[model samples]
Structure formats: structure tokens, C-alpha cells
Target: MIIIKQYVSIFEPMKKIVVLLIFLAPVLSAQNYTIGNWYDFKKGAISLTFDDGHPSHYNTAIPEMNTRGLVGTFYVNFLWNNSWAIEANDVGHEIANHTKSHDSLSYLSVGELHDEVTAFNQKLENDLGFPIRTFCYPYGNGGESDSVMFYIQDTVAQTHLAARSIAKATDDEHYKYDFALSERDYYQIRTVHMRDSMRSYHEDFRKVISTGGYMTYMFHTIGTPGGWDNMEVDHFTDVLDDLLLIKDTVWIATFRDAICYHRERKTANLTTVYAPFENGNNWVLNLTDSLRDDWFNHPLSIKLEKPTEVVTILSAKQGGIELEYTIVNDSIVFNAIPDNGHIIFDILNCEIPIVDLTVLDETIICTPDSVRLEVNYDSAYSYSWFKDSVKLEADSNVFFAKDSGNYFSEVKLNGCPINTASVGVSISGVCGVPNANFESDVTRQFKDEVITFTSSSTNLQGTETYYWDFGEGSSIEPGYYGPGPMEVSYSTPGEKDVKLTVTGSVSFTDTIKNKIVEIDDFNSCGIYKEDFNGPDFKFWHWCTCKYGYNYTMEFVNKALRLNLTDSIYGEWDNFKLFFYEDSVMKPFDFSDDLYKPVLRVRAKASDTCRASFSLLDTNWVSTAGMKMNQIGYIDLTTKYQEFELDFSNLFFYEWENKVVDSTAVWGIS
Candidate 1:
């Protein structure tokens, strides 16, 4: 009885296998198991995966992926052995959640579900310093609900990453079904497990290898697992060896890659041909559905009128395959590949030419400046511009209009209409009037330097009123004027706030203010530190006696002196010195040194603000052992409300400084 029971247990699985094979025989013979026609073709293409996060993978996969040579997503779960899996340096492999417990995700609650996937991703990012975009449900049992899948699709669409499920080719078809859930309408990809002894397995794999289609296999544990149906390591290696032997002929690729390639290669064509009306010589062949394959063996055919010369069928799929033929007067003969699969062909003869016309301007926002209209057409001999269908006498590519309205154009060839396009023009008043205000240094011993304010408008057609609010509680500037240039002036020591409100037939306001700080005493301020350090190197210094509370010092390089001065009160805007050189500044703006100096100052009585300097060095330069300058600062606010500064010789001195280098200089204050 015991022996019989064991035999029965073993026989049951065999029976199931036999049944499955019987069902697959007809389908396989018919070659109807193609990706798209019978199944979502994308799902049939390939599987993407990653192996154990071994050190070698980090050194190899990361750099290779960064170069776009390969892309393989990794499943990291083991905490001890796979700790390096989330290393900060790995670049290419997509670190995915493999669950904390490695338990079946289908059984977890929503919260637990979130923790398992989300937490793992967060942890990976926190540890690796790179985001994990793709995920593989732990244990191949991430039973995400349809609603959840929809949410994922929508969210992933907005992100640079996506999540996928693991499926087996032998799994029940229903479980593997790819359907439209939420906004995502794609099938879950299936993965093939590779284990030990792949070498021998290839012997059996040959039967399904050469179908001009995809043959995917899965393996787990190269050698047999202690339990269940597992193959030996030798067998797994054998399978891999066999695949390598035929690798030249087979496209072994990740599932995602395969699907993308197939989608791009699937050929379909739609054409409109023009034939002579009198002789019916112009034939229009519409090959809209010409190469749809539901299965590998599906046959496709195309029909055309018998002709004397071979007619070439040009299509996205043809790759320029020309058909040279003997065309008998009224018909053309051509042959299509028998394995082209299910296809739809439409052959028609027409007398008129097909033209597609489109307008270049979809949306136009009119400013006070001129508006340009462009017309595009498939095949037109000459184009005529028109306003309300009335032809306009304009030959230039652009039409200048002072007003706004609807405009259209027509293209004609040999007195025949070719195409027409139209555009709507909307004209509005200038956006707003420019605000003019003045600023000056009030505390200076000399006459206060006053800056004048000027305002202007684009188009002078409308009446306009201007209102200004000076910072010293002064009355608003009251006046009205037409569009053009305007100016204002100020002669006070304090910071001023100016607001300009413009009111016209159409109302809009433009506000401008002089963010100027007047320095009455230069003796009271003292700068303790200054430095510069980026692609280029330069430095500046101010004598302790020349330091004043409200005074400004200019770093005099080539010609441009970077002005270091106090900003608005209550704002942490202190003077910042830049180190990088502006190579182009001299040619255009006329500045001194290409590099700007760095600046450092105290924030308050006790605390100090420290700013680090950086240079934007190219990877090649850095790899060549280039270094950057280091600047130091000393806060003297406690004793004299000043700071001390020093510069280090860390900047790259070997690279010759070129005025045309055109690098940028920026400072953090």
C-alpha cells in the first residue's frame, strides 16, 4: 500500500505534464502562439533581470549600464550577503525590492505591502545614493490589485522608473494575462530562471530555438534543490553552453528589450497612390495591416494588377526591398514572404493626388512685436496668403500685422487647389508698463549719488497712468504717458522700495525697485576674508584700514572688478566673492580677470556663515589629476565686527588659462 501511494503521487504530476503537452501540440504546430496576434506581443519578447549583487557586478554592470551597454534590474533581499547590493557606487543596476522577509507579497496587508516594497526601495536609495526605479515582487507573488496596478501605472508614468511582476512561461495562462488596468495597458513580463547544468538542458532547448521568434526559459538553483523538481548544476551549465553555441542565431535578450525591438520592427504600411485618370495607370495600394503575425507560421500575401515591370512595395517593413518584375500592360506580379504572417492589403487606383496640409502655428501669443505666420504642406507648388479668403500681396515668409484676426492661406499648382491652412491672431495691449525708480548713497561725505528712474511702454496707442512708491514714505509718482522710455532718480542714503502701477484701457502693473545700499562710511566696515576657486584661479584682498561698515571693494582683475557690498537690511544677503573666471566676460562685458574672487563675512554677533568654493572641472580634467583652490575665513565680529581671510594654492596651475575658455563664476552668500 505504501509503495502504491508513492507511485500514485509521482504519476499524478506526469499525467498533468502529458495533458499540458497534448494541449500545446496543436497550438505549437499551428505557430499561433506569437506575441501580438494571439497574445500581447510585447509580453512575448524578453525578460529583464539581475543576478546576486556580487562585487564583480558592481564593478562591471554599473559602469557598463552607465554607458548604455546593458540594463539589468537587480532583486536585493538578503541583508548579510547582499549588503553590497545597495552600495553607493553602483550605477547601472536598478535596485529593486525583494521584501524584507522574502515572503510571498500576496499575503501581506496594504500597510505591510507598502512597507515591504516602499521601505526596501527607500532603504536601497538611502544606502546606495541612487534611486531604485524598477521592482520585482518578492517570491514572484506580488498580488497587486487591479486598482493598485492602475495607481502604479499612473504614478510610474510620471516618474523615470517602473515596476514589473515575475511570471513563468509554464504558469497558468490566466495568471499571466496582461490587460488594461488603470492607465497602464501592458502584460506582466515573464522571467526564465537559469540554474546549474544549463549546459545539458540546451540539448533539449534546440527543438524550440530556431523559430524566428522568442524562446524563453527559466531556471532556479543551477543544481537541484533538495526538494521539488530541480535540475543539477551541471545540467544548468550545459544549457547555457548550448545557448552560447547558437547565440549568433538567437536573440537572447531581456524581456523588456525584446518587446521594444519587436514593436519597432513590426511592419505595417498605408499608402495613397495617384494614377492617370484616363488610362487607370495610377494604382493606390493601401498596405495598412500587411504584416501582423499572431503565430510564427502565419502566412501573409499581397495582390496587385498584373503588369510587365516588377513593382516595388516600399514600406516601413520592406527596408527598401524592391520587386523587379515583368509588368503585363494592366497588371503587376510580386511575391511576398510566406512567413510574413497575417496581413491586410489595400490596392487602389486614383486620379487625384493626396495632399496633407497643416498650420505651423498651433497657439500664438501676440506681443507688441510683429507676428510671423508659417504654412506647411505635403506637396504644394505655390502658396498664397489670404485674409478672410481674400488674397494678400505678401511674398515674404513672415507677415507683420498691427492688429489681430483670423488668417488663412491656400496652396495651388497648375491652377489646381493643393492645400489650405489657417491661424487665428489675437492682439492685446502691452503686458505692463516698465516701472522707474531711483537709488543713491546717502551717508557719503560727498554729494549723494542719485540714480534716475525711467519707464516706457511697447505700443503708444493706449492712454496710461503710472504710480510709484518710494521707500522714504514719499507720495507715489503721479502722471500718465504713452509707451517709450522713462526714468526716475533718487538722492537718499536709505534703501528705497519703488512700485509702479500702470492703468490703461487694459490694466496691468509693472513694479521695479533699485536694490541699492548707500554707503555713508567706508571706514567702519572691515572684510576679514576673501578667496576664489573653480575652473580657474584668482584672489583679492582689502587692507584692514580700508574696511568700512557700508563701503564696497571691487576685485580688479583684467578690467571687471567684482563689487562686494552690503545688501538689504534684515536679509542674509552678504557680499559673496566668486572664484571661477568668466573667460567670455571680457570680450563682451569687458571685465578684468576671468576668475572672480571669493568673499566671507560674519552673519551675526556670535554665529558665522561658511561658504565652500567649487570649480566645475570636466571629468577628463579631474581624471588627469587636476585640483581646486581652498579658501579660509576668520570671523572677527566679537572683537571688531570683521573677518580674516586666506587662500590656499590648491587651484589647478598646470592648465594654461585661456580668455576664451568661457567658464562661469558663481558664489554662495
Candidate 2:
């Protein structure tokens, strides 16, 4: 509120007052509403919403909406992953909650309802930083009783501002924007189901437009045709085309925006005061509303008519914040979430124009099948086509678009340039890639085998992006947006679900499937560690010293167990198991010459055991080789654990005549 104390002197000139009016005239969007007239007094509003968090909804529906410069709401669920919904939220679309488990709420108690409704709201808010106001009913099955429905709204989903349910029957032909609301009417709002045939949706939309009502649409699975509520991308785009045509007349908003605007306008008041000050006139715009701050804080759009020839505004400010405004014909339109506070501004000196652009997207991929250019339907405006900045000879309404070039249409109204919308037409890239398809060369390969994958999909147009996952824990070309076969290998033996995900820019669709494939692990050599599967130590040797102690070694159940029983402890109470420890019997040397550690031997004992795995090799410091011993200690009285001894930690030693240690070579333990 601006309070002015004026003391105008009789000597003040009229020229000074006229100059003062010129200063304050430019900053005004000078129009006020007779309260509760929403969106230039449009008949109704419409919001495009999608559910189930499908991949195509983000990759397909969002890009299609962005082409028309419209945003939507996604009732996000953990269909694939939370990250996908978070990505859609980051793209400036509303992300709403749809519960953790998409289950029927037929017999859920109050506590279970919280788990389904309130808890889901908190989950989405925590993950995406998106406040959950709108929710979609899981399967829309709360039709049991009116009292139960009221219980859900008043108690269970009390946190949500409103909830949407599937009302295909009631909303198909008899849909209306209910201006009147009970306590639970908003929470139990119904939405028209959108599927393959959008004729019903379009009809209801027209009905809403003709009758001054609202049409709320719900869709799922954009490219997956014939699936549950399958709305194909092309069929969906057909509706978006007509919506863009009527974008100016209709208020295309998210459900939250529409509901908030309805509540805010019912109590909003815009007041302007004009009075004489000491030297100039004071024009202050005071905005006040009765909505609470917690629930209703969204900005309301204000359309202000240009008061004078000072129409070209340089700046407009309120509460010290520079307001976002636009020029449409002779009006300076801006927005403000009112708070009974006064805003002060002055006329800005800048030129602006009013362009009624109806084109959704200019860039078109030229196909042998079809293409068309948007000519101005209004004969009042002159339209001309251009290719690469060169004017075409054709000035007709229907210009068939062909060839590849940067094309644009210049629209002139009343002999003045209004818009110059351009379209970049290209003859490259795929057009209709609805599903991702791929194949691998072989299902099962050895550990060292390199598996190959290739694409075999229909409706592939131009350039493509490819992702390949070899299910044995190897991935190739991640986040790669192109076409190529992927090759990778696995180390262990297991079955694999090799998946390939490919998405095309022309049509955003993905194929996520597991191609049957298997892999084999590395074949083990019985030198250091093995499940013993041969004759028991035949080629080997064992020595047992008798001092009231005896030892017996045998292969039992694919395992090697050396049992010992000692009645008395003596100096010779020892047993050594060796692999032919003689001069001619040299230990096995790894052919790859690769240094490997961790000797694993599964063993069980009858008594407390102490044994040493001795290796006599020539790779030691001496030419004749030194004896390197790795100790194994276990007392597996009931159970056995695999003993893993790392040979890399062995001490390096060389001997001269088995006496003095010389220069240390590579240790063999």
C-alpha cells in the first residue's frame, strides 16, 4: 500500500504533470478481471497426464510434448526404476505419487491406506524434491461404498490435495468441470481414459470446449501398442497437433496448475489506485487474496492493457522483484502470486510485437511417404516459403515439402513482419522405431569367447543409439546413442540375460529383453587347488613316521582328506604329502608363466593338524632350486574350510651348494 501526502503548489505548471504521467504509463499491463474469470475467460481447461512410469512416457511422450511447447504431469511409480521418474521430473514435468505397491485398496485398513497413500507421497517428495499434491488411484477400485471412499479422502490420503481416478464411463461423453466441491469431491476426481483410439478423448475435449468445462486425460505406455491402455506415439501426437492449434484459446495446464488457479482466483482481488501526489500521479497495483500460504502460493497470470503510446515497456517490478511479462498485441501481460502488497513500476521504452504462432515444430524428417508445411489459414496474413534463405516462387497455401534444407515461413500481418518460424528438414535418421530388437551370435561361449550382438528391428529410420549388456557382468557402449554390435567376455560360468536397449531420436522406444545366453568358467588345473576327481595320490608320494602316530590320505566325496591319530606326541609325529618329490620329478610349471597366488585346498582332519605344502623348484635363487614351504594349519574336527595360501608373500631365496644363500631369483612357493 502506497500512502501519499500531496501539497501541490498553485504555481505548479500543467506541463510537469503531463511529463509525470508519461513516466508512469509504460510499465502497466492495464487490465483487471471481474473476479473468477480464469485464463482470458476460456470455456474450460485441459491437462495431459501419464501414469505407471513407463520408459516410453519419458523418452516418447515428453519429447512429443516439448515439440509443441507443452508440459504434462507424470504420476510416477517404480515401474522400471526411480531414476527414470527423477529424470522426467528434471525435465520440468510434474512428478506425482502413485504408491509403492500398485495393489487393490478394496479391504485396506486406515494404516494400510497410509502405506499406500501418504507414505508414497513422502517417497516421491524425498526422491525428486517434488511436492506431492496430485495422486492417481491404483486401479481406481474404491467403488465399494461411499463411506469407505470418504474415509480414504478424509483420513488416508489426507495429505494429497486431490486424487484422480479412472472414470472412463462417466468422463467419456458426460464430463464437466465441477465448479462446486464437497470435502471429498476434489480427492475423488475422475479422469477420462486415453487409449489407442483418441476419438472419445477428442470428443470429450470438444464437449468441454463447447460447454465451457474441463477434460482431464490419463495415458500410459506410449509406443507399446496393444498393451494395457496402450496409446501409440503417433495416435497421441495426432491429439497434440490439434491441441497446439487451439493453444491460444484453451488453457492447457497441468492438473495442479489448473486446480491451484481455480482456488486462487475465487478469492483473488486486483486493485489499482490513481491519485495526485506532490508533483506526479501515483499508480499502484495492490494484489490481495484469501488463500493460505501453505496450500495456495502459485502465481496468477495478469493481463494488463497498454495505457498509452508508452506501450513499449522497459521494465516492470513488484516487491523489488523484476516480473516476467509478455507483450501480446497492445497488452503487457505479467504474473503475480498476490499478497495484498503494492507493486510500483514505471513505463519502459522498448519495442514489442504480437505474433500468433500456430506451428508446433518446424523441423521435419522428409520421408517418401509424407510431409507438409504449415501455411497461415488467415488470409489476412501473407505467407512465403524459403529454402536456405532463398525465396521460393510458390506463394500458395499448400506447399508440398520435399528435399533437405533449412526451411522457414515468414508471416506478415498488415504489411508488418510478425513471425519467422523455421523448420530444419533433413533426409537422414530413422523415422518410426517403436520397439528395440537385437540378437546375439551364440548363446553359450567359453570363458575367453567374445560375444557379438546385432540389431534386427523393423521401422528403423536414420541414425540409432545402441546399448549392449553381456549378462555375465560385462557391459559395452553404455549411454551410446548409435548403431553397432557389442562384443564382450566373461570370466565365470553362468547363464546370462543379455539385453540390448536401443532408442531412436525420431521415435523414442526401447527394447529391454533377455536373450538366452550362457558362459563357462575357467577350467581349473589340479596343480594348486582342485576338487580331487582322480586316483588318490598315485603319481605322488607320502611319508609317515611311526612313533605311535599313523596317517592315512584318501579322496572322499570329491575332496582330499588326510586323517591322523596320535596316542603320544614325539619328534617323528609328522606326515608329508608330495607330488613325486624326486630329482627327475620336477613340479608342474605354469605354461602361461603368469604369477598366480592363493592356493586353495579343501581338507578335513581327525586330529589337530599341522602340514606344509613344499615346492622344490629351479626358479629360486639357486640353479638347483631351493625348497620353499607354505604352512597349512587346520583342526577341522567337524567341518573343513578351504585353505588359501598366497604364494606372492613367500620369501625369495637362492643357494650355493645348498649352504650359502646367493642372489634371490623369482620365488616358487
Candidate 3:
């Protein structure tokens, strides 16, 4: 933010410079104007002042401002129990009076007025050891007959510099009166603000600047509101931010400074003197402005044209003290005070050139053959190379590598180092990575099938580890790279993923035929491992082909136990169960699908009798009467053990020719 010089000649109403291509021409005013006799040439001004010192003002608001190096003026209602008002003053904050007892001076008796308004100012001033000039009427009321205003100006607390009113006194005359320091300056200095409208400070500030006058914003008890007339800390700080933005052009100061500046400018005197410099040497100048140093200590800004052919300034001094200066296009600008008397500068020869520079480092790459890195740049620069962050001994644009790592190149221009990266390049190298391919005997078949596997790995060279993952709690530990066929089997399976992996520096994995063989684990054959509860023989009606031996069929112990009692077995006693679904007879068939038909049964019998489950067609009778279909012979035994008979390979012959309908229309017999 630029310092706003309130020099009273704030407006150059008639004089302004209008430049036309390649030429600047100043229009003379016939009269030089200053903005309100100010310190810096600022056109507008503002002050962040709070009223009725609330604890939030001290505890919350001030710290936030202090962090940002800002300060506020607090008008305390001494009668209120707000204990933080004194702390506000202790921190260099301006504390003014909001009146004792906070009585409404608009209607208060003369005696009550003095007690509420006058007494509060003196009491606060005495306690804080700082004279209080700025005042805020309690509840923003100036007594019934101008008592508060009269008191501030005359007898109550003569130490007071200025008092503010919140009546909005928006009348043009009042604004000009306050801004122009007219008769009603103290009582009628109208504020351009609204309650709780801190959010609008940015635009509101523009209004103050447009008016080009002394505009004072009035508030009551900032921080958490003790009443409806208070403001939030965030809301207050928002206004502060708006003030800082124009700190360069707008004069932001305490209410007291506002009154002091006008007084100081009236009495202050200034003069400028310069010491002659040798030809082609330095030039020096001193300026002094005398006012009461303690009260008018605001820094003044000075701008001077750069001397002919002066390249730069080496140093600046004021009263033997070094100061910072900015040399802007044929102009030297600096801030100083009259108290220091004058400023001196040593001119020097210096030329700082401007150039666009960028640096880069190429990332490392891992490949197989060879790696080469190179750079592209202008020849005007001196080149230096680096490898892996270490400055290389060579100064070249290209760096050839026997090993893999990061590399970069730097160029020096006018003794300044500028670095950049190499062009990305890489080659091939070795690290174990193999194609895990394998071959299997068959896929999609019955369960418990042993699948023979043959490894077909490619580019395999390393301390390799081999593994076989048979998708179901089944795994094989890795073996060193070598070996041919590995035998594996699947039991009780569906589609089991038999995956093979060969791991090393770079691991590899693959599955035989991209999918494991799907096995129909007896589930599709209905209930082979079931009791009579399943939908097998329980739902099929049973009858003897020709009853010869005494037979009993019953469900016992959850098992379908067919008993043949004390008799010799004969082929005529064969029992067959008919397949039925809702009384619609359908033949058992698996020839349409892939699973080869198989008959498995658990039986118990003696040497004289044997039981077996087989399939026989109703149309099986031929010239050979009572011919059997596909019948599986069972072994006679007293103990029970299940045995499987693959009827898919079964066939029958009649008259020197094998029956071709072996898989046609079969019932459980």
C-alpha cells in the first residue's frame, strides 16, 4: 500500500500531465495543490476506530491486527464491567472515552451529563497515563444541548483532540464541515459507515476517496456485541484489510493523528538544499520539515529525477544513518523525516541485464542394451556436465554412460550458473523376466482327473522360483528353474484355475490355456453320494422285470436299502426304477452334453447274492429274449464300499452285431 500524502493539495483540479507517444508534457496548474497539508501526498484518509471497549476488542480483535501490524482506537464505556479496555491501551492501542455510566446525553441533565461524559474521559486518561482526545458519545448521543460536543471542545477534558458522532450527519454541509475543518468540525464530522456492514468496506472506502475529504467511520463496541450496535471481530478485520490495500494512497491513522496533522501542517516549515558533485560523480541533497517532532512524526515522501548518466545508487544516508531507496525510471524515491535534516546518496556505475534461464535433470531409466544422454542449447553459454547430482569433470553437451543413473548439464553465462537436463535415452539389459506358459493334456472333464502339465517358459535365466497354484487351498512351493513335466490333480472341482508362476528379479505368471479345465464333480449326475432323501430313486417308481427271488425294498437309516432275502440271485429278478417328472416319463440322457455317463453304487451282499445299478431301455427286447442293456456287475460282499462303473464304454451285441443305441433311453436298473 502506498502512503497517502494528505497535503491539502490532494486534488490537482486543473493541472495534470498528458503524454503522447514518446513524449511527456506537464500541464501547469498556474497553482500547485497539496492534499490537506499532509505528510505523504495521499488524496483520501481513513481510521479504524472502535467504540465502547469490549473485551473482544482487546482479546480477539487487537491480536489479529497486531499480527498484521495494524492498530485500532477503542472508546471505552468506563462504567461498563468490560475489564479489557485497559489492556487495549497497554498494547499501544488508542483508548478513548465512551462516557461513564453510558448515560444518554441526548436527554441527560447538565450535572448527569458531566458525570457520564466528562468524568469518564478524565478518569480513563488518569488511569491509563495517556491523555484521551477522541470521544464516542454513549449510545452515540451528544447531550440534549450539545453538552458532549461542548465538553470535548471546551472544559471537560481539554486533552481531547477530536470527538466523533454516529448521527450519520450525512448532510453535504456537515461532510464538508468535517472534511474542511469548518466550525462544526468536532460535533459534525459525519461518518460514512453503517452498523454491521463491515463486509462492504472495500466499496465503502471508494466513497470516502471519491469525496476527497476527511471521512471518519464510527462504530460502537467491536468484538462480540454487548448490544445490537456491536460488530464481530471478523467483520471488523475485513474493514481493516480494505484500509491496508490503499495504505499507499489513503492516509490511515488514529483519530488523534487526524486532528494533529492539520495542526502540524499549519506550523511546520520545510526547506531543501543540495551539495554540488564533481563531474561524472555522485550527487547529494538534504530536506528538512520542522513541526513538533513528538506529535508530527509521520514520515514524508520525496521523489527526485535521476541525475544524467547515473547508472545506479550505491547507498543512501540521512543524519549519518543508512536508508533504503528505490530508483524508478529516471527518478529516485525515498522516505525520510525532517528530524533527520537531510539525505545523501553515493551514485555508482552498475548494469544489471535481464535473461530467461531454466535448469533440468534427466531421470534415470532401466533398459537392456545401452544408455546415452544428450543436451541441446545455444553456443553462447559455457557448458559443464554432471552425473547423479555430482559435478562432472567434463564440460560437454553429451554424456555417454557405461552404467545407469541420472545425468544433467549446466551452462555458465556471465559467471552465473544455469543448469538443465539431458535428452532422455535408454537401452536394454538383463533381469529375470520369463513368459510363464504351459501345456495341459485336456480341459473340461470329470472330477478327480489327473492333469499332466509341461512347462513352456521363455527367456528364463536367473535364480528362478517356480510355483503352481491350484485354485482351492492347493499350492506347490517353488523349485529352481529346470525340470519338465509336473503332475497335478483336481478333486471335487468345478473350474479350477491352475496357475503357474516363475519369480525372480522380475516376476512372471501365467495359466495353462488361459483357463483351467472345468470338471463336473458328480453334481450334474444327480445324487451319487446321497441317501433316499435325494431326487434319485426316491422319485422313480420301482418294479421287478420278472420276480423270481424274494425281495424287499425299503428306506432304512436314511438309506435306500434293497434287500434280497435267503434266495439265490437270478437274472429274472432284476429290479428297474422308472424315471418320472410330474408323471411324464423321460429317459435319462447325458450324450447331448460332455460328461461321459458313469454308474456308481454302494452295495452290501453275500456270495450267493449281488446287487448292482445299471440302465436298461424299455425297447431293449430283441430276438434274444430278456436281453440286458448296459448292466454293471457288482462284487458280492457283506461290507459296503462304493464302486464306479463307467457305462459310457458299455455295449451289447445280438446276432454278431453290437447294439449302437447303447446311450439311448436308459432307466436305473
Best by lDDT: 2
**lDDT tens digits by residue: candidate 1, 374-414:** 55434534666777667789743455544566676555445
| Tens digits of lDDT, candidate 3, 1-669 | 233233222122211222223224332221111223344657666666776665666667778777766666777775333235556666666777777766666576777767666676678766666666667666556521364455433433233445676656455443331364532354434565546754665776766566655567766555655655677766777777767787777777677666556544443333334432543435555443333354345455555666565565667888788877676667676666545555667664543222232323323323343444555555655777676777777766555654555556776655555456444433223435555677777665445446666767554564556666556522343344343476655566677776666664664432222447666543111222223232332234243433332233333223322332222333322444444444565544433223444444443444444544455533344655544554544544545455655544444334446443333323322
Candidates ranked, most accurate by TM-score first? 2, 3, 1
Worst window of 10 by summed lDDT in candidate 1:
11-20
Best candidate per TM-score, number? 2
Global Cα lDDT for candidate 3: 0.53
Model 1, runs deviating above 4 Å: 1-48, 53-63, 78-253, 257-400, 405-408, 413-470, 473-496, 500-669
Residue 92 error for model 3, in Å?
5.8
TM-scores vs. true structure, each candidate: 0.30, 0.45, 0.39
How big is the positional error of residue 298 in model 2, measured in Å on the Cα after superposition? 2.7
Could you tell me the C-alpha RMSD of candidate 1 in Å?
20.0
Give the Å error, residue 552, model 2: 45
TM-score, predicted candidate 3 vs. hidden true structure: 0.39
lDDT of 2 by residue, 560-654 (tens): 33222221332223334433223243333322113333344433232444433332323354456454443433443323344554443333242
